[model samples]
Each structure stands twice: as structure tokens, then as C-alpha cells.
Target: MAEYKMTTPLTDEDVEKLKIGDIVYLSGTIYTARDAAHKRLVDLINEGKELPFDLKGSVIYFVGPTPPKPGEPIGSAGPTTSYRMDSYSPILIKHGQKGMIGKGKRSEEVKEACKKYKAVYFGATGGAGALIAKRIKKAEVIAYPELGPEAIRKLEVEDFPVTVVNDCYGGDLYEEGRKKWAKA
Candidate 1:
């Protein structure tokens, strides 16, 4: 249950020290990619094609934000359910993706990938899109503009908040909380 202030392109050392239930205030860059974009990314990797963004030390947020209002960088940027990306996640992690931001439980395979690759799974507060958008200082669709909201966008964030749902050492906050309350 520690709170840390971290910057992205997070290193393996940075992710390894985090434990499930720890809170993180992340600053710096992150990229957005939903299920549609994820499939494309995996396909590129399998083909040995170059990706749009460097996967090394990158964090991907599972979100497709609404169009920004006047003078705003983004709008209603909320996390999508994580399971939809489960199939592509381990592949990305193996390629150097260090963290993810989304809601809901991750698949066991995702957990195993995090453990094997020294990555982490983070959960953002769902239904808090507008609030989350405030943390995003800039956003630009870097690829697949045809995918609309599902496009890969490079984002600059300051103090973006998240919780460690799954840690590299095999800790899972969701399962731990369930067991704790079950015993109470």
C-alpha cells in the first residue's frame, strides 16, 4: 500500500518494485490503444514490421476518448474493460510494454506475462472520464486515424492516477481483496 510518483517510459526496475495495492501517480508519456488497435499491433509484430511507436518502456491506456471541447486537449477519457485486450497484451509485454492502464480483471495469461517480463497491470477508475481527461495535457493520433477513437494516440500526462492491480511478482490486488473480505 505505498504511493509513488513516477515518470514514464518506466524501466523494469521501476515496475519491479511496485506491489499490488500500491497507488501510482504517473507523469510523462503514454499511448492509447484499444482492442482494434491492439490486433493491428500484434499483426505487425508477427510480420516483423516496424510499429508506429516504440514499444520499449511504453504504457498503453485502453481508452477511446470523446472529442475534446474548446481549449481542451481531450474529453471524457475513461478506461475500457481490460479483458478485451487480453489476447494481445502478453505479446506486447514480451515486446517491452512496461505497463497498462484500464479497468477490470486481467486474464491469467496477462498476469503470467507481467511476471515473466517484469511489467505491471494498472487499473484506472472507471466512469471517471472527465476527471481523467484533466490529467491528459496533450493527445495526438499517431497511427490508424481511420480507427477514429480507437487510433493510437501519444499522450502527455501529468500526475495521471492509477492503482497496481497486478504486479510483476505475481501479486493481484483484486484477488487479495476478495480473499481478505471473504475471511472477515
Candidate 2:
């Protein structure tokens, strides 16, 4: 795999260079969306209305952060469970979304979508809230602020760490990596 430096509006070349289990320090523009926000976004797409943000080459982070401390952009930002969003991801992927950042096992449909759409899913370390929050340089609510933490926030980050969980070629690190260490 080739080395890639993450930047705003990542390209297929950036994503294609990543392999399962490779760590990345993502920078540039990333959009936050959770369960409630995803539901609304998918609904809008179904209605043929404009989405708050473009999906093409975009990365969606599955996070609901705590209130920021004074002079801070955010607090305790971390990936949430991904299964809850499985129903909605295919639609987003179909529309040109390229990447997703979250934790835990994903549905097969989601994996299929990644393969079909040439998208990737990254797994952020769970319980590393403070560490993760430090990587975020700025944050601002772009939509759905009434939903509080569920609001879609635009975050600019630096060296935001993640491991590639699912790759476009159907590689899954969590399962395969564990099996590699499993006793015969």
C-alpha cells in the first residue's frame, strides 16, 4: 500500500491506497452525523430534496460529542456503533459518499455497498475520546443543531488516527486480524 496524507475532499486514489489494518491520520473536512441525523438525511434523499452537504467524495463520521469545554472546539468525540446506520449507508454510498468512520462490526449490506461503490469504512479506537478530541482543530454545527450532539458538525482535524476496517476489495481487518492470532 502507498502512503497517503488525508485532506479535504478525499479522492479515490487516497482511499484506494489504504489497506485493512493500516493506520491513518486524517485531516481536512469531515462531517459528523449520527442516528437521528442520518434518518433525516436519508429521508431528504428519498424525497429528492437537496442534502445539507454533498455526498460525493465525502466522509461521514458517526459521532455525537459531549459539550465543548471553554476555548475548546469539542469534547470526547468518538465513533459510535455502526450497525444502527446500516440501513441508511447504502443510499449514501450510492450517492457518491466515499468513506465512513465509526466503530464495531458492520452489516454485510454495508460491506457490499463499499465493494459496489468503491468506498471504505474506517474503525476509530473506542474509548479514546480525549485523544481523538485533541486531533480536532475546529468544529462548527452545519445543520440539525436542535438535535444537540446529534447535530451535523463540520470538523477540521489534524493527524486524526484510524484503522482501515473495511476496504473496497472486501478485506475485513478485525475478523482476519483476530484469526491471524488465533491458536491453531
Candidate 3:
């Protein structure tokens, strides 16, 4: 699969070029939201209330980072399990959210949303929180401070590595990988 370096606020053209298993090193801004935050986001969408951040062309990371150490921008910032947000992901994707960063398989609904909306699901390395935090240049709580670590944060990342797990064209790395390895 091809590898690409992309910055955030991705366009349709950017999403279109990716396929499952492609390595992508993303740079620029991405937002943080775990299950609690996702529920809030979907609630806002259903109520026609303005979201904290624009959904169009945005990448949301499924993470609730730890407290930052002295002089650092963020603490251990690894991906959370993606499936927990599956219930809310389609709504976000339908509203123009372009990418999601997390680990594990997504539901059929989420994959369908990616296919229908020209969005992608990216999988960051699990258990590599400290290593991943090195790529994050900045992080600040943008909403829902009461949720503590689960609060939404805006993050500036540079060369943050991820794999395209589900693509806009209906490719799924988890399925393909199982098949490929099983045959071997």
C-alpha cells in the first residue's frame, strides 16, 4: 500500500486517495474525544446546536490523554478503542467529520459512514502512548472540562503515524489482514 504524509482539515480528495493498510503520517490539528465526548457531540448534532469545533474536514482522535508532565504539551496520548464510539461516529461522519484515529475494528455502520461520506478511520499504535505523545506538539481542552481526561482537546500533531483501517472506498484492514494472514 502507498504511504502518504497529510496535514489536517483533509479534503474529499485527500480521503479519496487512501485505501485500507496505507500508512499515513498525519500533521496539523486534530481533536480529542472519547465515548463520553462522542455522546455529547451526537447530542448536539441531534439538537441542531453548534458544535465546539467544525466537523468539516476535521480529524478526531479517540483519546483521553493523561496529565502533562512539567514542560510538556500532553501526557501519554495513545488511541482508545474505536468501537466504543461506534454508536456516535456515523452521525459525526454524516456531518462532515473527515477522519478518526483510534485502535480496533469499527462497526459496519461506521464503515458504511466512511464509505458514504468520504471519511477514513485511522488506527494508531496501541500501548505506545508515550511514543505517540512525542508527535503531539500541543494540546488544550476545548470543551467539556468536567469530564476530566475525557474532555475534548485540540491537539497539534506532527508526523503522527497511523494506518488507514477503514477507507472511503469500503476497504477494511482488519478483515483484509485476517484473510491475508489466514491464507499464509
Candidate 4:
């Protein structure tokens, strides 16, 4: 119901202020990790190995961008289906990850983790890869390069648009919106 402009490495306070359905324009550093990258990250955690990037206050974007063209910082970068990362998300949240950016419904465990860990789930426009790519100012493969487009990339974004799909207070926009329209 509100709009917020946030810069990443989001804090507990930052995520606490958000609610489902709120619009957000996120700027600053975010990491991209698709399913393959997530599995590796989780595997590292389980092995007690140091991760490629610090997890504290981190926001992970679930995307596997296409190869860039002539002069772009990134190619078409859109959110991947969120459920694919569900199995790994709670573990990441437990380690101080404060936000996630992706599309589609998440599992109950993910939602609970968001509430328990003061994290938030953000939804990016599903088919707006080209438009979203314009918001990414810089991108560099930080880990798992062999995974190709599924590699973990550190990204600097500016005013990247998103919506708060699930918030720390147990709000879920997908369910709320569906219930609101179900009777119409």
C-alpha cells in the first residue's frame, strides 16, 4: 500500500518497514543467483566453507540473464520462478540474508523464514527483462562461472522496480490480491 526507495545490503529495520503490496525501487548492490548457484551456496554453507560474498544484509535476485549485446552492462535480466529456490532460501535467510527478488509464489517455509529472520520477498515484473536490465548499472561474475548464465553475479542496480510480495510481518500480497479479486 506504500512505496519505498531502498538501497541494498538491506537491514532488519529496512525490511521491517515494508509490507505486502508496497512498491519498492531498490538501488545499490544485489547478487544474482539462480537455482544452480543457490545449491552451491547452500552446499558451501553445509560444508562450513566461506561463501564468495558476505551474506549479512544481502539481497539475492533470482535471475539468469542472457548474454549481453554490444554495449550493455547486462543482457535481458528477469526474475526466474521463485519456487525453484525455495529449498535453499530458508538457509540463506538464517545466515543474515535480508531480501530476495524473484517472481511467483513461494513455499510456506520461505514465508515463515521471512518472518522469523526479518527478511522480505520482492517480486519483479515477470516479462520485463529488457526494461529491468536497464536498471542494472554494472555486473560481474563473482562465483561459479562455469554455471554460465546461472553463475552468481554481483550487480549494482539503480532504482530497480519491485513489489513487496511477502514481508516480515506475515503479509503476502499474492494471497491478499487473489482474495480481493476472487469475489469480483
Give candidate 2 regions above 4 Å deviation: 1-3
Q: Against the hidden reference, what TM-scores do the models get?
A: 0.98, 0.95, 0.98, 0.98
**Which scores higher on TM-score, 2 or 3?**
3
- Give lDDT tens digits, candidate 4, residues 37-145: 9999999999999999999999999999999997878999999999999999999999999999999999999999999999999999998999999999999998989
Shift of residue 33 alpha carbon in model 4, Å: 0.5
Cα lDDT, all candidates: 0.96, 0.90, 0.95, 0.95
- Per-residue CA lDDT of model 2 for 1-184, tens digit only, reads 3445687577778777888988877888899999999999999999999999989999999999999999999999989998999999989999989999999988999999998888899999888888899999999999999999999999998888888999998899989989999998
Task: Put down candidate 1 lDDT per residue, 32-79, tens digits, no spaces.
Answer: 999999999999999999999999999999999998889888889999
Candidate that would win on lDDT: 1
Number of clashes recorded per candidate: 0, 0, 0, 0
In terms of lDDT, the poorest run of 10 residues in model 1 is: 175-184
> After aligning candidate 3 to the native by TM-score, how far in Å is the CA of 62 from where it should be?
0.4
Candidate 3 ranges beyond 4 A from true positions? none
Candidate 1: list runs displaced more than 4 Å. Answer: none
Per-residue alpha-carbon lDDT of model 3 for 1-184, expressed as tens digits? 9999999899999999999999999999999999999999999998999999999999999998889989999999899899999999999999999999999989999999998889999999999999999999999999999999999999999999999999999899999999988953
